[model samples]
Target chain A: MGKILQKPTGFYDKFVRKPGTYDQVTHYCPGCGHGRIHKLIAEAMQNLEIGDQTVFISPVGCSVFAYYYFDCGNIQSAHGRAPAVGTGVARSNPHAITISYQGDGDLGAIGTSEIIHAANRGERMTIIFVNNGIYGMTGGQMAPTTLPGQITSTTPYGRDAATTGLPMKMCEIISQLDAPVYVERTAVTDAKGIMKTKRAITKALKSQKEGYGFSFVEILSACPIGWKMSANDSIKRIEEEMIPYFPLKTFKDEIADRTPRPVVPVAPSQEDVLKALGHDQKEEILFKNDKKFIDDFTTQKVRIAGFGGQGVLMAGTTLGMLGMELGLDVTWLPSYGPEMRGGTANCHVVLSNKEVGSPVVESPNVLIAMNEPSLVEFEPSVTPGGLVIVNSSVVVGKCKRSDVTVLEIPMTEIADSCGLKAAANMASISAYLAFSKVIEKDQLVTLIKAKFKKKSLIEQNVAVIEAAYKYVSDHVRG
Target chain B: MTNDDKDIPRVEIIPEECKGCELCVTQCPKDCLYMSDKINQFGYNVACYTGESCTGCGICFYACPEPGTIKVFKK
Candidate 1:
């Protein structure tokens, strides 16, 4: 038997690392804002009492290992994918206080789509965007936040507005969105700047604890190495140059109050938790026949892969939740990579009566690859006698293996024709379901509408799903 | 937790370092830290040290800027 060591008490005490523990001795240059921002965020988490219920998403950059200092459940995102992953985390675990930390290059460049959409959708999470005016991690490169006339490796002779667009104001952009409850731009140039930064960081965190949707804090930080200046000079630049352009102020704060909601205590003996799990948790369940999938099938692994913004994960999760509603064992595992923002994303769904052996599917029985790249990437792994569905717009070739059946459907064209481009992802997923002959149309339609609460979206998605079902029935000749 | 019981830690504000952002004064769990009438070498009206009651939680240190400006030692 292994040794049973004694661990520490509550998460608070256990998480409090060392005196100078600032999230793995951050990769920031001397006098850089990353360390200060990290400390302030950690402190805010501590003060909010949401430390235990917090899950941080750190984008790939200098501070990728923000988890080391955060002392919480951390999801290290592929470069620029923090917002997408944070969206999933926040949506799945509504109780968790989700935080996404991204550099200017990560957030403003590759992650622009995810950040904008998440802010537009009003996800209840906190975003601490570190805008140091240049890409510090990747050898002092030009970033989206690089100011005019600011020289870097990418912009050697100083940025010219004629050549490069104006330095983006992310807080201003985010403030335009109605969903975000709070958006602020602050700096850490001087002692006073640090004070304002602390307040902004703390306020943004508090908004998340209060269930306010999408709080964003853009922190103008120092980049000593990238700015080609000494530590002291960088601070001076932040005061003299950075602050004038990115003024420190609250862009938007829609929250009625910043205080956290009081947790209502319950006497344990009085209420039934089982009933809450079974009956009170209302969600749509998808299954065929009177018997639930969990009670019938031993196991089922579903893989759905597609380009970014195609609702691939959403479709898989919606189906997974349907399985849950049918009292079937279900798990929705997301395939995350750097291609989250307008590139590609995927999810694996498992439905089973017994416990699943492995979540990773080297040879998935059912595969839905939206793009040509995804098919090329995942096609070799489809098991013989399995079904493979590819998006028609991208996939045009035949497979090498004849044992597996490949069903090509014009998902994008169909969705566009149906006046629902977003439904293309749903269409591909429905095609897989149709070919598999698992879970009938009526039940799936019911589940889809329930998952897609919007009436118009439900109508369009249902049409898209039905069209895919019809296409699968007509096409795929043996 | 009341201010009357004087067992809290004392807060020291280094005027030269304090930018007068009021983060400490505003964020104090107990509204004890305040600006003093006296001025420091920086010529800015700095925050005064109030030792009546304090919690040695080092929250002020976490918030303060000057590396050693705000120190909290137990009695």
Candidate 2:
């Protein structure tokens, strides 16, 4: 029999964990707006019923222990990269809801590029930008959002535009972007303010669940410790000071009917790959679901490369699992780097009939390069007469080597033709099935369909896969 | 465990002012303070704890950064 622990009624046992509940104690200074903002966000997540699928990215500062409070998948990111990391999660698994919680110092300063670019890309995500004027986590340093004439650790006397520049208006800047479908600036200084902030957070979360692109809610939080004021005084300061500059208002709300869009292909990023490789300090800040695949004795090696949003990694993961299901050893290797690419992106997969040692595919037996760069990077490594699949639209230049049989197919055109714009994943899966002949076509489709959580998305992807198979079978000959 | 317990200092948490930051819970040497489901005026859970279990250590009081949230009194 298991030991039982008892507690008082109305006490949330799930809220507490071993070594004590992470929420039992908090780090925010008294009167700090962070606590209120955190509560509001948590409540909104609970109300939305996305506690399981939701992934929260915690930024450096007073709210670093967000994982301890939010009862969901938690990724703790380095200062300012929460939005960037959240973007990766949102783009990779469109089905899961991703939330980034950040402070003025983390988001407005160090993460300016990541935040601005993410919003500009219109990546489907919900961001909670907490602006408390001063950097609470770092002991009251002057943040970019610090109000003019405000005294902080850095700005000893007062923030002067001539010397320190004026307070930055982030919400106003975010509103200027064409991609942000929903943007709001709210506060949590008082009871009424907390209510408004909660509404804004819930609305943003709803938009994200609906697959609306880039919903941002900026909270005019308070820094009671930094301000050297009482909790009540902090509330008074918000009413007297912060609200005048960052007014509570909704900037954008453009989605029609508010229903979430259908399954979208994953966007694999070099940054996401780097984090996956444990290169970043906050590597653990990624939302990795349960091991999506299980395997046996054989080994599998694969390479997938294509334009940025083609679901190269997903296809590899799907295939990696399929190989595992067949009792084969498997290795899935994705690319890691930074490049301003509008073309194709790629990933490598290795599934072997035996024990596999290395996951990196230096020379692969089967190669699928979706763009020119990937082929150029991987083609030299393919063995003689090895199967090489390239997107016909991108295989503009000659494949200098004739030793390898290169099958150029209009994969992009095929995906677009199937009413599934991002069906390249399905196309690649089909090609790999026919080329390797490793597993039956029906088996592979069943595996992929089971992986797709949504019933509606399965049909669209299945149609694309069938079309891809028909194309490969009719055109390619062994 | 006796009437002498009443002789110890007591710590009180202001539910209205508490944000459930849990800073006090982590810093409590005896591990006493915690987040309570007791709803506040804001309709949210507030961090709370009874003073009976307190050892007069004043750790929770010092750890609480929120003003007017944690108060200590000598019994």
Candidate 3:
């Protein structure tokens, strides 16, 4: 009888196949270093006996497919954001070991500040940085670590160092800081080099497992296809050109004399958690458990669209808060990415008796359009029997849809008469509720009094809401 | 499990898992592994044993990156 040498338990037994077939092969090009680096990491996880406690954070690059190989907890981060994600995972799951694996473009170009900040804070995690001199995944683009005079798809004329500057050495930059218990640079070209890389990977993981602070291992790898060279020539290039510039060495290793990280969170007891949440659970849950509110038929799916300064999101939030106060399930979703001021902004609000499955009011039952463009964009999406409130002061055009009810109110004009143009949101909401009979006017007045304390402001707001409602009711309803 | 006196170690390559990287062939000290002439189901040449030497050092196993691509057995 004889024993057969199989792979380590750190990887999935088989690869995910296509829709109809089972294929276990990786799509990586021949002589790529990512596969070799993955092997070393898997070996380290096996040798250190941390496969169960390991969590791998992979950012966008060749290593993003790491979850397919490693049988550990995996998280896919946005482009160049693995270090930030790994920091959160490490601090929250203190006992678990975190590994942040990234490539040259991810760490050197867009994610420079994220890695620097994470390392400066001394996050308890290990980073395996693969520097292949070019962006291999995104069609051989020029990365920040591309060597001077290296020819790539972007730098076809041979990289101009005088204009583009030199390649970044991450190990040297990280070692200059006071934190980071261990830092090393290794390669995987030959048998001896592979052995050294395995040891370096083991050391980095060990440092993280021992509760030491930040650790990083930068591996100078080869991308033969991206470099447009054969496997043999790529290995020689690592020795002749790459090794001299980026030497393999341990820049920092004080694991034997390092100090344990402080301030690991201790889980609070059940009574303490309950006290912090609420001492009187019965009273707090009464609002959510009301039968009459949940069974009401006055549910509204509202879409508020306008320019950013028009308080579209604030209007949605106020409506949602009122829904929650009246014992209804509410959801508010804003549709803007950092373009909130002076640009087009919109929000979707759902106040329903049943559970709200989605917060997207694609065909809104109620639309409050505060501008002409907003009305033009969202008017056709209203339900057949829905209500659309248009700001007639800014929206001069009439609604073309014949199926839905249209209530055109001069919201800005009423707000101007009420002494503040910012009260347009109050006017629109008040008019919609009064016409639809969704909520009692007395209840609204009581709630408004509880919210605003100043007498003059309350009087102006009440006058605007009432004025908009009376105008809409008299003209549109009659 | 004890090996017989006349037993020698050999390698088995699952053709589907091989992408013809030639990593194991370069790492093998005995010149035993080589790429086959025909391609597999994935349209890439797979590795094949030369049957010239068999030391069973398992260096080829370590060099092959894709897990479960090659298995070494003493028979």
Q: Highest TM-score, which number?
A: 3
> Each prediction's Cα lDDT score?
0.73, 0.72, 0.83
Per-residue lDDT value at A285 in model 2? 18
Candidate 2 per-residue lDDT, tens place, B41-74, comes to 5565677664456666654543444423566554
Report the lDDT tens digits of candidate 3 across residue range A282-343.
Answer: 43321335576467756699999888888788778877877777777899999864874888
Cα lDDT tens digits, model 1, A1-478, are 1211111111222223457443222334445567667767766776677778999997888778566556678899988889889978886787888899998999999899989999998877889999987777888898888889988898879998898898999999999987888999988755567778889988878777777778999988777777777655777788788888888889898788444433333233323664755544553334444565445564667788877778888888887876776667688889777776787788888887666677676678888888777888888888788888878776776556688887878999888888988788878877877877676678788887666667768888889988888877887533
lDDT of 2 by residue, A356-413 (tens): 7888887776788877878888888887767788887656865777887777777877
- Say what the interface RMSD of candidate 3 is: 2.6
DockQ of each: 0.05, 0.05, 0.34
| Winner of 1 and 3 under lDDT | 3
Model 3 chain A: lowest-lDDT 10 consecutive positions? A280-289
Sort every candidate by lDDT, greatest first. 3, 1, 2
State the TM-score for model 3. 0.66
Comparing candidate 2 with candidate 3, which one achieves the higher DockQ? 3
Task: Considering chain A alone, report the TM-score of candidate 3 relative to the true chain A.
Answer: 0.67
lDDT of 1 at A363: 73
Error of 3 at B41 (Å): 8.2
